[model samples]
Target chain A: MIATETALALQAPQLMTTPPLLTMTGVSRRYGDVVALQDVSAMVYPGEVLGIVGESGSGKSTLLRMMNLEDTPDTGDYRLALPDLPGNLFDLDRFARRMLCATRIGIVYQNPHVGLLMQHTSSGNVAERLLIAGERSFAALRGRAREALDASEFPLERMDARPIELSGGMQQRVQLAKAIALEPVLLLLDEPTTGLDVSVQALVLDTLKRLQRDRAITMVIVSHDLGVIRTMADRVMVMRRGRVVEQGLADQIFQDPQHDYTQQLVHAKL
Target chain B: MTLASLTKPWEAMSYGFLDASAKRELRRKMLKAIAVPGCQMPYASREVPMARGWGTGGLQVTLTLLKPSSVVKVIDQGADDSVNAASIRSFLSKVSGATETWDTTEATILQSRHRIPEERLRADQVLVLQVPNPEPLRPVEPNMSVARQMHADADYGRLWLILYEQIVRSGRVMQGAAYPSLVNGRHVMTPSPIPRWDVPKLHMAQHLTFLSAGREKRLYAVPPFTRVEPLVFSDVPYQVEDHAALTCHRSGVSGYFMNEIPQDDGSSAFEVSDSHLGIKTIRQAEGAAIRIGPTWYENGKMPQ
Candidate 1:
């Protein structure tokens, strides 16, 4: 229902320069009696970071999952504007979806355990996506892994160490390295640093910001932490009870929140 | 009680060493497995005369389908006369009154362990491969229930991850035998411990292949014309062993899979892994009118 956000802050002039990467309209999802999301519409433009900030159970994670095709919407139009793929993602088969997800988009989960194979080495984790993407030569995989790990500020010495041997910060860095290793057009992140110590959170965020700039990747991040959203997002969407309450550019939303929930979130964080 | 009454009444043994009910069960499972290619169907792998791991699975399938008119061939690692192969061949013949044959062309029902015959199986032939471990997901997920669920979901990401890791660590997918493959493009199946060289023989081939793990109580099939594709990145093509260029020391036959025999001084000797093929080649060279069936690999390569 057009509850808020009449004009997206991306600006029409800038929109003319590049087409949107993902667009969803009237997307809804339910789990039995629980309506996780309802009539949520959003668009992700190229090379920009869009953040969905809401408290837990506000359907932010659900929206993020739908973007990654982890869950399909019950009723709505969800399309991915990838050059190689047709406009409507739902029209493609699972194999096409898998290929698109593996090669064109990368995702980092909240838990390092979910994002990584525990038995594999840290660099091996980064090399995993490339391997899946059909990079055959071990030398090429190793070289790319080294470069990505270095870009994520991971130490070269511990490249071969298992995930359990590294700290939470390092594990997140490995995840980031893997997510960016394929140089994907889009990256989806779900609470990438929530479990890390507050002091260590900035390190992962900094690495993410640097990777985003270097790769020019359009990113969608969902989190309950306003600080994370403020530090990373170019545009922000404030959601409440499965609907978008307010959305605009990062400075506009933070400096002058239109919705009461957005105002509350901004004030509590400040 | 009378001595004859006290002694148990002599009941005749069932044909093929299995009762009709057990054979019926296996036949049902086989039909289902063929209907849904590559999907492992659970079955009651009845106890057989042999040990649990040593070709018991193949023996059960052989016994199930065995008949007086059937010609059975048993191969242990491609050696027709291996002790295990010889024992199983004789046991099958002893129970079913079937003719035992070492010639791949003559085999109506061939049961093999570790290696598939180099001779291409015909449409009328059935290959029952003995499986020690049935679950291809065993390396990734240890829990069988979870593994079954993973298969149901087509969640083969973890399997691909293992192949990915192998490349990262060892510079290649070091999975030598029981290479995991996608059957009919849906189910990922382990084609038993047959070498990577032989996996292609199952892909869209004329013969039907049944891989059974009696110890694991599971069986799966690759019906004729079913796709059996090994898991490899599109850029990284599947590679068989580098035995094509090597010639057999005994038969002087080249362009087939070979066994490496290490010497005391470090030089190795190469022998054709298929002993029957080697014997046939040697006999043909001696002009004894030996007939060799068409091979899967021609000139050391599967005709692409």
Candidate 2:
């Protein structure tokens, strides 16, 4: 077997005591008048879900996008080591870089409705990445997309329906279908369950957890909702003013925040 | 009249080929293509005096689907002014009552034969192709029923054998005509007669593809983000036949896909070509080359 293909075969989630799926060291991103993220260093470990919690303008989204290479940092380095892939994201030019994102790293945006292709049917959205990955047989695409939708605990009949026709929760499920279809190594959720009701959010979160368990998908979820962070994250980082104010194991951060800002933010949630 | 005059006609509607009802039927098929993602559907046929070979499939789709507010761009064999291309452009303008432009970046709908626009089409735009044959298996097996059954079963053994044959014959897959493609992972459809060089543009293309075959009366859509791959072996690999031997006539673009123009010397010659944008992009590429960032890689880096 070729070294690359063998490397892919050998790749397994070394989650229990692995280094990290992603690492941002001294990363800084600056716009003309505002600094989005400043010297922000963090590690998204394998197997565990890491939550970056902060308020509206707290740079959580910026940090998440930076990890996805959606927004490249103005200074410092960001490294993403996908299993069996040569080089990091920055090594590829524009075309190959995008192909990498479609193949390895999948991002689900906050607005469930907008993230999916509205015009395409639920099945279309779910099977998009597989097609991009060059799975060209219709039967294969349909069977795989159907299986994915089934695995998500979403209805099979609704697969033919458009996003607009489906409920908010189903839309999130479709988004999940798209993200998980490729079985990406690093899954980035930018508040995926934001618009759903509490019950629906629970279902969505449960589905995500199940998927993460089934595939050793390392996830980094960005959100301001403490409840979501507490439920999903194994490790938590609280940010304020473009910096990590407090970070620790979720239980530890929830019980005892080191920074005053973290305390104030947590207390306000209470 | 030859198809060359179908350029930039304003407020012209095709005399009577696509009546209101026929257009509506075509529109419905287009919507189904978008809805089903990769499924091919039948479309109402429109008669174009220019005949089938010269982009009538592309022109018909453009005419039936074009909105009055749309800006249409047309290209043939990747050149804007190729006789066949000019013909389609004029036909679209005269029939659809839409405006036509040579600027691919500005066009809302692009009618193309044998080439994707050199520029990446926008998400809002639609790309219509004139398909000689839509089925990738048509060449291997003449029977559509057998081919459809093979597609239905996802049976690509025959297609794989053909690719393997190419590898056996040549060191690489040297077959470059209307390259076979896997669309949305459900169908292995042809991107009409576009060269294999233009095949990569169809993969994860931001714009949608509305392909029609006037002869077969079929229409299909490859939605944006739908995966489109040309069948190739991992070792041999599929490759685009870029113009390593020629340069753009207007802007001196070297090694892009080119169209042959016969010279006074009685030998076939090539000029820089992009069907969607015409020769104008050659000039733009020339100007941009001077300011190109060092990080911007060119066609030379394409894997051989």
lDDT of 1 by residue, A1-270 (tens): 234443442233344477777877787889999999878888888888999999889999888878777778888777778667756675666666777777777888898898897877888788777766767565677789999889889998999889988899998888888888888888999999998998889888988888888778899998988889989999888888888888878898999897888889999888
TM-score of chain B of each: 0.96, 0.82
Off by over 4 Å in 2: A1-16, A83-88, B1-304
| Per-candidate clashes, comma-separated | 0, 16
Q: Is the docking of candidate 1 incorrect, acceptable, medium or high quality?
A: incorrect
Give the true-contact fraction for every prediction, in order: 0.15, 0.00
Which candidate number would show the highest DockQ if scored against the true structure?
A: 1
CAPRI-style docking class of model 2 based on DockQ: incorrect
TM-score, candidate number 1 = 0.77
- CA displacement after TM-score superposition, residue A199 of candidate 1 (Å): 5.1
lDDT of 2 at B277: 37
Q: Report every candidate's CA lDDT.
A: 0.87, 0.73
DockQ of each: 0.17, 0.01
